[model samples]
Target: MSPVIQEPAGIFITLEGGEGSGKTTQARRLCDWLTAQGRHVLHTREPGGTLLAERLRSLLLDRSAETIAPETEAWLILAARRQHVDHVIKPALQQGMIVVCDRFSDSTMAYQGYGRGLDLRTLRTMNKWATGKLAPHLTLLFDVPVRLGLSRRRGQRSSQNRLDREATQFHEKVRAGFQTLAKQEPRRMVVLDASLPLESVQRNVTTVITRWLNARRRQPRQR
Candidate 1:
């Protein structure tokens, strides 16, 4: 797909990890901090953002819903992502808003590609097509052991989803997939030890993001 809009002036940041990796919390914190710095921030999440995309998110996560085929799951997520990018992310970025998304294409690659045995290359192409090649300026991958992450999820009384019910091996594959991806794109991705206390993890995240923003500010602007 062709570019939906010219390169955006704003920064795009995404958080990725297995269940209970504190991505949502960190995303909120980052957005709050960015807003405090007088930046226009748009905090959003994958598989859901716009109305249509949210509906798809429901279908994707509903445990009572019919067993969706693996390919069907991939298409549904891509469809929601297409809507999300077109309706929310792209417009926000064009308006010079820092978009802090909870999960994005990387989740799909980790879940369906690694967890469900899908083709990573094909999924990458589909993700590019869905989002019109809009990639994040920074991605924070919260790394944690599969058992620990799953245990945390089990302890959470609310927000349990179908994905959370997957076998341990599935989550292990997903975790490994994220590790591989972070290694492949070290510049754009920062792996954080998520097993640390909330304050410690947040401190690391804030430090890394603050340094990145400062560095970007020091760079000469393009014509």
Candidate 2:
């Protein structure tokens, strides 16, 4: 079923990237910045954010979990996303709270469709149904080389997960998928160099988001 579009006062922003692209860190930074400005913000992540979704995340990320089929993985992610949207994202936005999400439907497209060789067209349709066609107003894609991003993850003790154990070539495909997506949706997605120093990346993120917010403020409200 298609979702009825509702014009919300709050904005939805999402962060997308391949493994170890610093999405979680950058999302937190963005939330802190927005919170400092006296804005009501909800910082949450995908495959999570709701109680059931978090359990799904554990299953998806657990290295010890049974080997999951590619289609099964895709369906699990979509299920979690549906719950997240219904229980967390939709309500927050309706309440006029800016929602900064760590990952969203794009991750499914990149990871499952691209990395696992699933059909992109089918994935897109499923994602729309899962999310009720609730597209993010802005998506910040943290672009980084596969090797570099993987290396950064390896350096961290807590970063190891099921996805992190995938073949290097799989990650390359996912990275390429993100690039292809960015090219296709240049207006809604902004590519930032995640290889830069943390402070530099955050600076660019702040500047880009600031401009978007300013322009949003200038627009007349829908009656």
Candidate 3:
């Protein structure tokens, strides 16, 4: 008997936002909607989607894990990203599954590059090397005020992740970082008002994604 093999011909979508911006909520909603539409969607989150990545996520999030240098944190994230892309994302995509990731390279740029004051040039190089040639077809950025997101995150019952436990200034920097990215890449990035009602936000996001998918479907097949 021979093992089965599957090839993926699907799209990659990433959801990004600062803490309490409702990214997780929206990501789940988007996944459910896509599945209902008969798409094979693989929903995952960054820093811990795979076995190796999950272990790193634990260390990265533990508040008492000792102070992690900015450059070191950046390297750890990129390392997880490289392994995650090679093992999980690439394989799922090859299986013809739409991959909806909760967070991707943008988080590293926002959290590490801007928030932690790491060099953006280095972050870009790491991202490019980690991802190889694949890029998300669409990125939904749930934009919210820094204060509002911090308040919401603080309200969560679970102790904040190490990153989340950072001072409010850090989170504000992250919010600004994401805003900058959205402005820089308006075409591939959709900025949604996350403060809006969840239902309304979800509907707007769905409409935009559906339209993009339709447009892609209309394109002529390449030889």
Whole-model Cα lDDT per candidate?
A: 0.92, 0.94, 0.87
Model 2 clashing residue pairs (backbone)? none
Per-residue lDDT of 145-190 in model 1, one digit per residue for the tens?
9888888888886878999999999999999999999999998899
TM-score for each model: 0.95, 0.95, 0.92
Candidate 3 structure lDDT:
0.87
Which ranking of candidates, highest TM-score first? 2, 1, 3
Task: Give candidate 2 regions above 4 Å deviation.
Answer: 1-5, 220-223
Candidate 1 lDDT for residue 180: 92
Worst 10 residues of 2 by lDDT: 214-223
